[model samples]
Target: MKKQHSRPNILVVNDDGITAPGIKNLIEAVKELGNVVVVAPDGPQSGMGHAITIGKPMRFNKVDLYEGVEMYKCSGTPVDCVKLAVNKIFKGKKPDLCVSGINHGLNNSINVIYSGTMSAAVEGAIEGIPSIGFSLDDYAEEADFSHCLKYVKSIAQQVLDNGLPQATLLNVNFPKGNGIKGIKICRQANAKWAEEFDERQDPYGRPYYWLTGVFQNNDKGEDTDVWALDHGYVSVVPVQFDLTAHHAIPLLNSWTFND
Candidate 1:
């Protein structure tokens, strides 16, 4: 059994800015488990993925958002928020755990590849912190989070009690309704975004393209994240940052190299 710290230092981050209700509820869920420190984006950064702010200066300011919680708003991307928290705020002392999101919308299946919420958790895992990103399927600004609180607390506590494997983080997505069946540990669905660009004229008469896409899930496996989410169950997918295709190495070695 993993030993528990009396009060773990928990780093909380998100992509939906500091004032979003999603982050507020997330902080409330995990605050009792540790000393909560929030370092989040100042504005919405939903589809930023793993982007960091470069070619420009980044800034942070202390805020009085959540009472008794140390909070800061960063003028950068979600990943930048994590970097700043580790280097500037924590001063190289790694937090016991990191939790991202309670995001306003879903981050399951291929959506995880484009989600800033999950990217922050990925950054935390890369920094050797046990991390999890939570998201709800609802996209409304006033979506209710009450249904997800218990599960969020349980999952966070579980991670605190049992550290995750190296370079791995969890992408957890909750169904929008209150009648959620339960949690399901599942693999990422074989999915892609069917994309198209909508071209329209700007006010200045210049053509502007708006990117839009439909989520396409081709995997028929019942053990996939998408299936779990669709069946009123919360999906928890163990995500790894290592993008290497290790199985392809042996096939590549069989090719002849011309000198």
Candidate 2:
């Protein structure tokens, strides 16, 4: 970690391409906090969870956007951006922080499973770096991000000051309205999408399907990230990359498999 007085190196990334306004606002919010380096996808990579380029080669190009900030656009997924940022840009030197998103839409609850924004942060956590992913409840292209700035700065500063737990990163979501409550540290809500596919015939007489779904929040707990965002509060959920079902180990150990 850099000294308290020294500016720390921060790696900024996103699922929405580098030019997305959400990322621009994020840069504006956290730029003064550290020396910012941006590495993001060249195009939207939403719903691409933890995907990396393997079959084909991946490439990146330096961009002149975001004046005074070193930015690069990568032809890969959000996870790929993080990998390239660490291996190519930083040259194996892990940054002080890795922040992804200020995403175009909410990444609360079940959305985290498919969110490229959160995946970038997850990649950072895998690399043993303190990371965060921010999102707003609104999905509009021109969603107002005015209320999110202060919270972003606060959370980023806090993470910089007191690092996150081992192998964990944060998934933060902001409410849409202007009547903002306070920030809340909460758990991931038990929720999922009830999906359906709409089939239609095209002009060429071919059928295509569009996936759609309704979010179902079955968890009634008020301490969950979903509840926090629903009640006009900014929700912060600590996410872990470990997929071990440790709780089931004891039950499995009691089972007899000898035939």
Candidate 3:
């Protein structure tokens, strides 16, 4: 059992900007669990999967938004926020836990690969901190996150009590509204976004394209995150930053490569 400090240092971050309602609710959920320090984008950085700022400087500013909460808004991607929190804010002294998001939309299945919310959690995992990313299925500006406060707090508390496996982080997605069945520990379903670029002319007569897609899931596993979410269960998929396909190594070993 992992014994957290009486006042654990919990770093809270999100891709939905500092002012988003999602982040506010997220802070409320876990603020009592420890010392909550927030560092997030100044504006929405959704879908910016694991991206980091390069070739340019970013602006970071401190603000007093939520009373009694230490928060900052960064002019960078979600991953950059975690990087800044781990390196600058925490001053290399790792936080006891890192929680990202209460994202405006779901990030289950293949969506995790392209989610700034989950990417922020992934960055925390990379920094050797226990992390989890939370999201809701709704995209409305006024989406209510009240129904999830209990579950969020419980999950964070559990993580505080029991640390996650090495290098593993959680990708948690909740369905919109009340009547949540329960929590389901599951795997990421084999899924993808069938994307296309819709082209149109701007007011200045310049052609631009908008990226859009339909989520495709063919995996029939009942234990997958998609199935859990579709059934009103909060899906918790343990994810890792290691992209190694160790199982394929043996198959590739049979093939000889010319040096």
| TM-score attained by model 3 | 0.97
CA lDDT of each prediction against the hidden true structure:
0.94, 0.93, 0.94
Instruction: Give the per-residue lDDT of model 2 (tens digit) for 1-259.
Output: 4435678899999999898999999999999999999999999999999899999998899999967999999999999999999999899889999999999999999889899999999999999889999999878889999999999999999999988889999999999968988999999999999999999999999999999999998999999999998899999999998999999999999999987
lDDT accuracy of residue 17 in candidate 3: 91
Off by over 4 Å in 1: none
Alpha carbon deviation, residue 86, candidate 2 (Å)? 0.2
- So what's the TM-score on candidate 1? 0.97
List of clashing residue pairs for candidate 2 = none
Question: Candidate 1, after superposition: displacement of residue 129 in Å?
Answer: 0.4
* Candidate 1 backbone collisions, by pair: none
Question: What's the true lDDT of residue 210 in model 1?
Answer: 95
Q: Give stretches of model 3 more than 4 Å off.
A: none
Per-residue lDDT of candidate 1, residues 1-259 (tens digit): 3757579999999999999999999999998898999999999999999999999998899999767889999999999999999999999999998999889999999888899999999999999989999999988889999999999999999999988987899999999988999999999999999999999999999999999888888899999999999999999999999999999999999999996
